[model samples]
Target: MVFSCLLFGASALAAPAPWYLWRSKLDGQVFCAQTPPGVGWQRVGGPYRDARCENTGVPGK
Candidate 1:
């Protein structure tokens, strides 16, 4: 269990998780996230190759 927690934390802190264009499942709003934004979030496009995914949109990223 401890190992799993540590692994998860390491990934969370790792540089440059995949950039995702996330859309709000509830409001159709778009945003960006390193991982899928938990529940209520959906992937907008394929994995963004750069930080351009962080461009203008709803501020869920």
Candidate 2:
């Protein structure tokens, strides 16, 4: 019984899911942010004059 309790406790303390962010390319859009166990997407910005996702907080393409 003690071992079973310990196992249950350990399982409850399991690591959490990771988090992530998604930036757009058209303009400087940033969205689609989410954490582990949860998933979602968002639009940060509008279409940029350039044909890249530059200025989206992300590095150059």
Which candidate leads in TM-score?
1
Which pairs, if any, clash in model 2?
25-53, 26-48, 27-48, 29-44, 29-45, 30-44, 32-42
The residue-by-residue lDDT of candidate 2 on 1-61, one tens digit each, is 9999999999887753322444544444454333222233344443332224333332222
Which candidate has the top score in lDDT? 1
> With candidate 2 superimposed using the best TM-score fit, by how many Å does residue 27's alpha carbon deviate from the native?
5.1
Q: Locate the minimum summed-lDDT window of 10 residues in model 1.
A: 52-61
What is the alpha-carbon RMSD of candidate 1 to the true structure? Answer: 8.0
Q: 30 in model 2: Cα distance from truth in Å? A: 1.2
Superposed by TM-score, candidate 1 places the C-alpha of residue 10 at a distance from the truth, in angstroms, of: 13
User: What is the C-alpha lDDT profile of model 1 across 1-61, one tens digit per residue?
Assistant: 9999999998886555556788898999987666767799888774655566744433334
Q: What is the lDDT of residue 3 in candidate 2?
A: 100
- Estimate the TM-score of every prediction: 0.52, 0.28
